[model samples]
Target: MAQVEMNRSVQTRPWFRQITPAQWQALLASSLGWMLDAMDVMLYSMVLVYLMSDLHMDKSMGGFLATLTLLSSALGGLIFGILADKFGRTRSLMISIIVYSVFTALCGFSQTVTQLAILRTFLGLGMGGEWVAGAALITESWPAEHRGKAMGIVQGSWAIGYALAAVVSGLLIPLFGWRGVFFFGIVPALVTFLIRKGTKEPEIWEARKNTRSDTEKEGSVIKIFDRKVVRWTILGSALSICAQFGYWGLFTWIPSYLATSVSQGGAGLSIVKQTGWIVIMQVGAWLGYVAFGLLADKIGRKATFILFFGLAAILVPFYGFTHDATRLLLLGPLVAFFGSGYFSGFGAVLAELFPTSIRATGQGFCYNFGRALAATAPFIVGTLAKSMGLGAAFSITAISFGIAAILVILFLPETKGRELT
Candidate 1:
């Protein structure tokens, strides 16, 4: 007990100084998986303009494919979350990486939109599963006080992956074309072996297994919907729905919007330039994720969500309405920063909200179930863009952000500094 107290005292220091070497390894492992996962999943979005021309797809069809991936990812997250709970997180993480890697590489072989969508669906399975496993693994291992910031590190890695995709797309799309761009996704799969060798199942998970009754030890996806858990499940899912919708709707279209011709109502940047712009925005996104973690830890989760969500609501229209490249260059980062930053809170909050047995399942279902519904946003935005223009379609996504902010305040309680066990 004295040793435990001493450990807790040490952990109360500055965030980075507090984590043990083992904790750092876990963070690195989770961050790497997430970073590469983002690269694999986001490859489709980054290369979307090229896919449109190569596959002869239009705005609606393109957005439909993005929606399809999200829908599939919901299934993936659910399955893997259950797996993480019942089997083990490290095992599930490796499996998910392999699943996404194989499917993402196969995407290069797709001959049509139908074929590509099918490959993306399989890829989404692994992509979504990795998050369930990785987030659960990190949250369970770290102290509750710094869990948000740790999640921020994991979530922030997505920006690194996003930027890497953009950079690679800018170079590869113009050189070997779209097929070559997807092939890079196969590289991340190599890290699965490292994960297998380096990481272990969380102590919290193992401790629960050793100490609990049969009823407590047994894992079930349905357990989250129990009388006491149902309200939390509902509120988390609802908030996630708004965030996912706003996110998928905007980012899915932004690259295409930048690359499209001014005559067709786009910003009219070249592919190379468009990729550069997206990369710059991802820097802000990375900071946003990191900042959200630190801020959530300091000010509490609910207030952090309000600040970021409010900024997102305000910036969506400002970004959408701007025509000049100069203005876009200035406003894009702020828009991406606020819009993408709140994600750091998602894994932290969901992990805090449930028991060790149900944590992964609860996080996966809340986040990905919302993902399934939010999947429609891209298609809706795409269909609307045909008539309203991409600017108008994007501007309208602010409504979802507004709703998300309200839900955070009204429904979800702050989980800051709450002990995980």
Candidate 2:
């Protein structure tokens, strides 16, 4: 009777408190992988000015490099999504860490713009692949009722990684220069050891693998395009495209915009000051990720997504137009919060959309292919900024965000609390 009562009590507790050790390990591994991925990837953006000067490149070239990375990341996502399905999420995640980490460190040795570009492209593969495995792992590990919160926490680690990059750039750029910062990216490679020790593949995936016949394994990729799932794939990709466009366009240039002179249509802050502001802004993003998850669990996924997307559309233009130091500081957090919070919903909704057979593959293709299309954002913004200024270039993200909101309202189904198993 005591044991039964204790089990009942545990079940009644809040989701965080009720999480098993295995669930916590999965969450931790996924969060660390994503955080390190952001740190490794964003180091380039954080030191873009240095790269431009050192490599004797122009803004278009700098933007093109970012674009190249995103395109490669898209390909990586597709390949690794299939890998995660076939091998295991943990194994796929481990391999991706090594791929991005070694390449990122190699970037420090690049002597020419061409070499840097090639290295960055390789780095992107790991960057893009990490999310598919991490998201699928989190979805399978956590309970259905609390999956949104789990996704939110993992997504929120992105802010932490971005903040770390800013801090590393601020401290190291003056001391060791951009090359040293790139070298530091090799640190994430060590994280694979922890993941290998602490994490295991979800039982759901194992059971599916054990029971599957040879014939059933065929056409895994093609299944995403089957008649029943095709609509969700289309709509999900559309939504992801809009979100990625807004994100990559804005963030890829934000560090440069903040550091540029006011006469050049930026806030004209110092490097250290810009880093501080970005870190503070990410605090809001972290909050937004968490709040969005809780709200998603309560109000439903589509509603929460619509809310964040619509607000982001409003906030993007406002943030872009402001050059006043005080106003820019104030608006930065709001922009980050609204602009980024909706991402948490994607992991949950996408996982719920597909079955265990191809969950990673389906979600990976939708998100990364959309990312591929959105890869144009940085180059377009750079070209536009050369003419109109960075502020005006940012206003375009508002349109993307607006369209994303509409896409969710018109087509996507609510997936809150949907059991993946």
Candidate 3:
């Protein structure tokens, strides 16, 4: 009977209770940082129509601005990856929060598209840095067996942030205009205090720092390309390129597509209705992120990663071609689920691919450099929309999704339960 009770207890044990208090703090801080970072970043997309109308910007111009932010963010990711390896993750994270917050708010005060463009460029720097620091922090803090689940929770918070941005836009845009929505970007800066008070650098990073040789101390970006790591780096970047292309190409224009009149080949949703639909869609995204992590931990990263991409490939086209309003509403969550969930695997697989010495630098480059390459996605989609309409242009993401699944099958190896050495 005692043995039976022991087995039952083990079966029923909550995953959270298995980690130490310090791990919990790391998870919480990273989740909040990622969540707030997403909220601030996505606010630009949420209010894209208002900005274009007020600033007299066309789709190409708007897409160019988004592209610029992404290019700068790629640079930021590379810089912060080295910083996270050299400085403590907590310190790097704190500074990044301040940088993006201040710039995001400044975007509100811009009278011209050029001004908003300049501010958004600066905001991209911190937006890129936060992920490098936060991903490293969580990967190092958690045990290998549970890392996928931990990263899943962190990535899942992105959906929550998106939903929050939708809610904020819905409520405040009516009262205070798009500027009011941007002003709330400053609220995330306050989260630095909680991070400062609650979090500590991962002990693994501290130990690695203490034992580092002169060359290793620099956390040189070139080290990521050493023969041992170069293959995974290239493969990782390819995967990132496909994923980012599919995501930005589709999402950047989804709001505009929804709000445009049916005569104009859109859903003709009011801003409020579109916002509500977006919020509901994020529920699917949140579930996708969490489920991807759990499934990755169980079945191995390669298989689970491919699964999401495969489903996304099919769903994106279906969602795009469907003209029925009710069908689109019902399809939103399913598309979001398969489209966005695979992100949960990225942190784990990338973190696993490199040693502790250059994990941040390697993963950062693979992810962000790919981001730079994929930066063309929005512009391409926008340019295509001018000719083919948003639905047809948006459906192009399905091809990108299919490519991602194929890449995973051909190149990415199983990295399940890989310890971050």
Clashes of each: 0, 0, 0
User: What is candidate 3's lDDT per residue for 1-421, written digit by digit as tens?
Assistant: 9999986786577877778999999999999999999899889888988988999988888788888888888888888999998888899899888999999999989999878989999999999899888998999999888999999999999999988988888899999999999999999999999999989999999998888877545557888889999998999999999998998888878877887778777788998888988988899999999999999989999899889999999999888877677888999999989899998888889999989888888878988998899888889888887787778888888999999999999989888877778
lDDT of 2 by residue, 170-249 (tens): 99999999999999999999999999998989989989889999888622789999898888788878988999999999
- Model 3, clash count? 0
lDDT of 1: 0.89
State the lDDT at 386 in candidate 3. Answer: 79
Mark the regions of model 2 whose C-alpha exceeds 4 Å error after superposition: 1-8
**Each prediction's whole-model lDDT (CA):** 0.89, 0.92, 0.89
- Model 3 residue 249 CA deviation in Å: 0.9
* lDDT rank order: 2, 1, 3
lDDT of 2: 0.92
Clashing pairs in 1: none
lDDT of 2 at 176: 95
Query: Of the pair 2 and 3, which is ahead by TM-score?
Result: 2
Relative to the true structure, candidate 2 reaches a TM of: 0.97
